[model samples]
Target: MPQPPIPVAVLTGFLGAGKTTLLNFLLKDPFLADAAVIINEFGDVGIDHLLVERSDENVVEMASGCLCCTIRGDLIDTMHDLLARRGRGEIKAFNRIIIETTGLADPAPVLHAVMSDPGLLATCRLEGVITVVDAFNGMATLDAHAEAVKQVAVADRIVLTKVDLLEGREGEDMLFAIIARLRKLNPAARLLTTHRNEATAERLFTMGLFDPTKKTPDVQNWLAAEAYATGEKRGRRHAHHGHHHHDHHHDVSRHDEHIRSFSFTEANAISPQGLELFLELLRSYHGANMLRMKGIVKLADDPSSPVVLHGVQHVFHPPVRLAAWPDADHRTRLVFIVKDIEKPMIEGLFKAFTDQISGGADAFTDTTLSLNR
Candidate 1:
């Protein structure tokens, strides 16, 4: 019998963003008791604290009750060796895999590798992407590095670390700004703040199509298109600005107008072909502009079930049709987190292809996209 695809989640963040802290927290879970963690060592960073036993030159078993090994060379090779060892019962038979990427590494390529590799595709599934953000330096990091921006944009979960450092009214104001900034970058992604408390591994671990337990996708929390469609998002944004504005201080969160999020809903069900055409066109012309796109579409042929689509950059993962709509109020809701792209253009292009998504975005104006700065 063939082995089921093992879910592999990539935990990433900028340097000093506390991914290591989160990883340590996650390894303590009983659910992940039989999981193999592959940690990527970049440059000369020492991870002696993470490993309790250096049984092998590269691999070590953590005292926190998990197996961890540093990727000494090729990631693919390391994974292959892991499976081979497990097959021979040399190592424990772990059912799950967690990959901790280097701080500055581009996570897209790691995702692409799993998607493209025939062997990894059959054995390992690219599951959730968890990105940690430093409450102290997150804003500065985003302003300075595009890599950091991309990490936030692609994450399934954003964990804000070092919030204990935030104190007083001034600190409170700064926290709001960073939260707002993260919201703008990825509204659909779930945000959790952790200073010293340990976040549940179950909450962060299972974010893919199905969890390790084989449960159905949590469409509501996963897509969260409603959060963007409703006025709640705008209210939250204004609330953030309100805090800074109350003190007569400038809003430091609006660092980059290029990266923004918007959503559009179509009342009528969309034909399968028409939906495909719109996506193709979107990816062909404005793919570079799109950072991430996800939606649960109501198919014209079968309105009873919804088709879920998720795309990163130009490359779209295979569309999956859920057994039923997540809720009763399932119209086609698509959310986009993009860079240097106006909402009107996407809405207009969507209209051109399907004539389904009507109306334009009021909050994200053309001027914001056209601004040189």
Candidate 2:
């Protein structure tokens, strides 16, 4: 019998965000005893790898039975070597894999590598992205670095570290501002504060398509479409007023303004061809700006069985069709996290393709093809 695919979770954050500390905490938990860790550093000497307590040289066995290794070459090659070694009885078989990326790295490439690699995909599936944010410095980092904003934008869970350092009224005010900014950047992600003892291993991992504890499809928690929908309305209202009143305190170089998170629902079922064309247009035209896109699509041929679509930039995983609808909300819902791409453009493109498939006039003419930002 074939073994089930292991879930791979990517842990990322900005510089000094305490990701290593969080990892140490998680490794101490009994639930992650069978987990394997791959640490990626951007220098000649791997400091993070040394920080992790280990027993051996190459594949260090953690005190908790978790295996840890530092990436010396290509990520794909390293993963393949690990799998081969495990097969040859060189290492213990780990049920979970956690990749800790360097602070300055853009997680999109990491995600692309895991999602696009055929070999890795066959044996492993993406669990989710967990991002660590420094409560004291997160706002400043996000204002200056586009990479930090992307980290939070693509996260399934946002862990705010260093909250214990914040004291007095001034610190309280800073924490409030940072939390508000984080929520605006990515409304779908679950936010947790370290000071409150909320960032636990059990709560952080296993954030995939299915809830292992419930043994059911957790579409609502995964998608959080309602949160994005609410954010979209607020954005429109802010835009209609001519200026963002809440953004007056921000600097001109703030990258958060470029990021947008929104969601839309299609009441009618979409044909397969229409869906294909729509996705193709988005990927071909604006894939670079698209940070992430995920949705449960309702097909015209089989409305009862919805298909889940997930993509990072131009690379998309194979659409998986669920056996049945996860909830009564049968409408096709999609959530998008993009930079410099507005919600109207996506909505218009989708409508045009679906309408054309429904026997309407060709909507792919130059006039409709014209894209603004």
lDDT per residue as tens, model 1, 63-88: 66667777877888888888778789
* TM-scores for the candidates: 0.80, 0.91
- Residue 267 lDDT in model 1? 70
Runs of candidate 2 exceeding 4 Å displacement: 41-57, 210-215, 236-248, 356-359, 364-368
- Candidate 1 stretches with Cα past 4 Å from truth are 1-4, 42-47, 50-60, 72-77, 80-90, 196-198, 230-255, 355-373
Candidate 1 to truth, TM: 0.80
Residue-wise C-alpha lDDT for candidate 2, range 1-373, written one tens digit per residue: 8677788899999988988888877888999998888997424433344344544565777777888887877888888888878888888899888999989989998899888898888888788999999999988899999999999999999999998788998899889889878888998898998887898888998578843445457787789999998877766676687364444477779998889999998877778887897888889888999999999998988899999988999988778788899898998889999999878888877766556345444554432547633
Clashing residue pairs in candidate 2 (N, C-alpha, C atoms within 3 angstroms):
none
Report residue 295 deviation for candidate 2 (angstroms): 0.6
What does candidate 2 score on TM? 0.91
**Consecutive 10-residue window with the lowest summed lDDT within model 1:** 359-368
